[model samples]
Structures are given as C-alpha cells and as structure tokens.
Target: MRKLDKNLTETLRKTKYFLLDLDGTLYLENKPIGDMKNTLKFLRDKGKKLIYLTNNSSKGAHTYVEKLKNIGFYEEGDLVYSSGVATIEYLNRYYKGKSVCLLGTESYRQEMINGGINVVDGDRADVAVLSYDTELSYEKLCNFVRAIHFGATYIATHPDVNCPAEDVYLPDAGSFIKMIETALGYTPKVVIGKPNNIMGENLKAKFSENDDFSFMMVGDRLYTDIAFGKNCNFPTMLVLSGETTEDMIPSAEKQPDFILESFNDVKNYF
Candidate 1:
C-alpha cells in the first residue's frame, strides 16, 4: 500500500459517510478488488455508514443491492443509490406532477413511479429524462428526442459516455445524450449525477441535517467520482483498482484528497 499523508488519516477517521463507487472501485465485472469485503467490514465495524453510489441508471437500487449481497459486500444498514434515484428526487423537486418520458429500463420506470413521478410513454411529455437504458429501443430513443424537441425539459441522469467493463466499455447515458443532441441540436438542461452538484445537494439534504456529518467519496474515476467529491466539497479518495493508474494522477483535473493502491489498502490505515 502506498503511504497516504497524515491528513488522509484524520479525514478517514472523521468521515461519517463513505460514498463508494461500485464498478472499478470496490469491484470490477462482479469481482471484488483484493480483499475489499474485509475492508468494507472494517469501515462498518468502525461505525461508518456505507452508501454505494453509481451513475449507471439502467438498473434500480434493488438490482445493485442483490449483486452486492451476492458478492458479500452488503449488510442490512448499507444503502445502494443510483443516478436513477437521484434523478427521481430531482424530478419530484422541480417538476412535480409533470408528465415525464423516461428512457430507462422497466425497473427504473417503476422507481420513477414509486418516487411520485408521472412516467409517460409519448412525445408529448412535459419533461424528458434520459438514463442508461439497458432495455433501450430505437422507438423510445426517437420519441425521447422528439419530446425534447417538442419543448419538454431535457434532463440526463449522468454524463458518463461509457461504462467500464472487463473487456470493452459499454455506451452509457452520455453516449445516448450525444445521439439525442445530434437529432435535437441541443443538450440536456440539467444532469443529475456524479460531477454535478444536484446529486450532492440531494445527498446533503437527505443524509446530513446541518452540515455536522461529513462524507468521503471513494472511487476510481477522476472526472466523475473524484470530481463529484470535489464539487460537493467532500474528501475524495481515488483507488487504483479500476480505469485510473498512478500515472494519471498528475493529469487529472479534479485531484483526489488521497490515493490508495486499492480499497484493500484502506484497511491498513485502520
């Protein structure tokens, strides 16, 4: 494990919430990164709250929860939060009772419903939300573009153009956003996930009462995870278990508060 600065130790000890990124941080393609389960157990045993955060909106929290449980990374008090849930909260706050045309999976649509959003299916929607729709259909894609062109408010779940994989990267919501923008000649008015302050604001609103509790964002991505933590004014830790490497640190626009060889290294400090 690389030796982290003394401030990192103080930060880790004081953090009340650990906002963890699943892919490329804790695990990759369904496998945990070197003894990560024990690392998470160490954090939990220290009375820290765990919140698994992801920008992929293709599947709802339940899907991620099940996956985490199967991989032995989840416990009763741990929470799974995706960009879809953040988007749902964003919609209910700003466009309450408005008809939304969501380009997401059926499970994500149900999450919208559960969050009190009036999910619709036509191009006449009052708001148009685009997510990483694993079940995306060409018809739905065209309709979303048309709806945005028809003057519906455009919103995106996140700006991740590609999702990392063991083999090749998969096109995420940002890729679809590019396609939609090509058709409409415009972009989303708001994006509600990592690297955006909306998600941070929502998290702050829900988790912390009066800025007493502190959050620590640990992830593998510079533009998303570390950037989100920086944008949210939270301590950030970049793990090298994913897409980023030691060489990438100097070039990262949003630098992390600390760098760890992997999530497993975190246990060493404890």
Candidate 2:
C-alpha cells in the first residue's frame, strides 16, 4: 500500500461503504483489471461494505454476477446493482403497468419483465426506453425511431457515450441517444442512472435507512461516475484504468477527491 496522508487516512477510517463502478473501474469487458478480489476481501475484513454499481443497462444482476465470478471478483454475498435495476424502480414508481418499448439487450428485456414492466414490440407503447444494447439491431433501431415519432415518452437508463472493452470502446446508450436526438430533435424525458437522482433514490431504498455509513464512490469516468458521487454527496476516487486521464481533469466539470493510476494502486492503500 502507498503511504496516505493523515487527512485521507482519517477519511478512510470513517468510510464504511464503497460504491464501486464496474465496467471501467474494476474490469473491462470480461477481463479483470487488478487484484480486485483480494482488495475487496481486504476491505471486507475491515468491516466495509462493497456494492458494484454499474451504468450499463444491457445486462442485469444475474449476468453481472456470472461475469464477475468468471473474472474472480464476485462472491455469493456481494451485491451487484445496475442502471437496469434503477430504471425498473423508476418505471414502477412513475409509469406502473405501462407498456414499454425497450431498445436494449434480450437480457435487459427479460430483467425488465421480471421487474414488472410490460415489454412490448409495437409502436403503441407508453414509454420508449433506451439502454446500452450490445445486441442492438437495425430493425430494433427502426422500431424505436417509429415509437419516438409516434410520441412515446422517451427514457434512458444512463448517459454513457461509450463502454470500455479490453482493447476498444463500444458505443453505448448515450451515443444511440445522440443519434435519435439528431434525427427526431428530442431528448429523453428521464435518465435513470448515474448523475441522476433515480439511481440515488434506488440506492437509498436498497440500503438500510438507519445505518449512517460514510460512503465513497470509486470509478474512472468523470461524467457518469464522479459526477454521480458529487451529485449524491459521496466522496469520489478517480482511477485512470478506463476513460479518464490526468490531462482531462483541468477542464472537467466534476472532479475526484483522490486520483490513482488504477484500482491496483488502491490495493496498496489497504
């Protein structure tokens, strides 16, 4: 572990929970980024709670669990939370029992159905939800555009432009959103993920109300991850393993409290 200043060490002492970003901060695609399992175990041993928070809404908790397990970072008890879960919570709260046209993966659609959303195929949907659809097809794109033109209320799970992979970045939900906006001249009515209050509300509902644990958000993206932490009043840590770089920090609208080369550097702190 690297040496920590007194102030940072004090803050660490008070922090009882870590809200972790998955895709960029911990791993890229199917590959692990660091000795994450041991680092998590180290934090666990210190009586800290860990929750994997992700903005990728294409996959649900089950898929994430399997992926994490494959990368050797997940255990039976660890919680995996995603924008899809938050989006479902938002839908149930505001648009309960409404017909939804989802532009997402098959897994995401199934998860939404399981969460009580009425996923439909036609243009006569009450809501048009967009996600990071890795399995996105041209036919699906046409259908979604048709729904938008037909006046279905638009919603997005998150505003991430790209999702990091091992070697390249895949265009994410935000990129799709920009395309739609350019074609139709409209934006989403609601975005339910990071840097949005819906996810924060969902987190509050998931965690115990009585437990006043000091929290920190650790991630790589300045917009989604760091902005989310700032918006929700949690301390933020920026990792350079993914989307962000040191040169970009000067002009960033949102900034981190601490910066590290990668999550591997974080392992040293413990």
Candidate 3:
C-alpha cells in the first residue's frame, strides 16, 4: 500500500460506500491489479459497501457479474450497475412506449428489450440511442444517422470517447457520436452515464439515505471517472492502473481528491 497524506487519510475514514470502476481500477484486461483481492477484503472488513459502477454499455449486468466473479473482485450480493441500466431507466422515465432504434451490440439491444424498452428497427423508430457498440457496422451508423435525420430524438448511453482494453484503446460511444455529429450535424440531447447525474440518481435510489454515510467514486480516467464523482458530489479517487497517468492530472479540468498508483494502493486508506 502507498502512503497517504493526512487530509486524504481523514477523507477515507469518512467514506462509507465506494462506487468502483472495474476494467482499469480493478483489473487490466483479465488480470487482477496487484493485491486487489486483499484490498477489497480490507474495505469490506471495515464495513465499506462496494458497488461496481461502469460506463461501458457494451455488456449488461449479468455479463459484468460473471466477469467480476471470474476475476475475484465480486462477492456474493455485491451490486453492479452499468450505463445500459441507467439508459434503460432514462428511456422508461422520459420516453416510455416510444419506438427506440439502438445502435449497439446485440446483447445491449436485448438488455434494452428485456428492460421493457420499445426497441424497434431503424425505419420504425421515434428515438435513436447510441452506446458502446463493439459490433458496430457501417450500415448501422448509416441507419442511425438516417433515423436522426428523420426527426427521431437522440440519446446516448455514455459520452466516453475511448475504452481502455489492456495495451490498447477502443473507440467508444463518444467516438461514434463524433462521426455521426460530423455527418448529420447534430448531437445527442441526453447522455446518461458518467459525468451525468443520472448514474448518481440511480445510485442514490439504491443506497445513500443516511447522512452519516459518505460516498466515493474510484476509477482510472479523469474525464469520465473523476468527473462522475464530482458531478455526483462524491469524493473522487484517481487510480493510474488504466487510462490516466500522473502527468495527465495537472491540466485536467476535473482533479481527483486522491490519487493512487493502483487498487493495491487503496489498502493504505482503510
């Protein structure tokens, strides 16, 4: 564990719930970050509730649960929330019964359908949703653009431009949005994931009734992860095991309350 200054140490003592980022902060690719298992245990032993929060909309809750369990970061009864869930909730609340055309993976589309969203074909849509489509095709992009041009309302699951995948970065929803914006000259009216308060609302709906309990957001990226915590009014902890580095912090618009090398370093807090 890395040593912490007095202020950060005090801040950690006040925190009760941790909304954790999975891919970078917990594990890089399929490999666990150093000493992560014991670090998680230490937090649990100290009565800190762990909730896995991810902006990756490509996979659903079940898939994430399987992945987390396989990587040994997930315990029984741990809650996992994804951008897809928040997007579904957003659709249900504001656009219930509207025909939605999803530009995402088949699994993400199915998850939308399972959540009682009215996902339909492009031609039949009244709204168009964009997400992290790992299986995106040129045809799908064209269809999505046409749908929006035809007056369909636009919404995005998250605004992340890139997704960290081990040694590489994959273009995420925001990148696709940029292309579409360039082509169609429009952007999504609502983006429901990180840096937006919808996720925080979802979190508060599940937990956070007690004033005595404080919350923290722990993740790797400054824009999505740390920004999310700031938007939610939760203290942010930046970990460098993934998208960000120490050099990236100075010019960042949103700075984290604490910074650590990896999840292994979090052990010093508790």
Give the distance in Å from residue 25's predicted Cα in candidate 2 to where it truly belongs. Answer: 1.9
Clashing pairs in 2: 1-268
| lDDT: worst 10-residue window of model 1 | 207-216
Alpha-carbon lDDT of model 1: 0.88
Q: Top TM-score: which candidate number?
A: 1
Q: Rank the candidates by TM-score, best first.
A: 1, 3, 2
| Candidate 2 error regions (>4 Å) | 1-3, 210-213, 265-270
lDDT, candidate 1, residue 190? 94
Residues 161-250 of candidate 2 have per-residue lDDT tens digits of 877675777899999999989987879998888987567656766774333237788898888888888888777888898778789998
Candidate 1 similarity to native, TM-score: 0.96
lDDT values for all models: 0.88, 0.83, 0.86
Clashing pairs in 3: none
C-alpha lDDT of candidate 3 relative to the true structure:
0.86
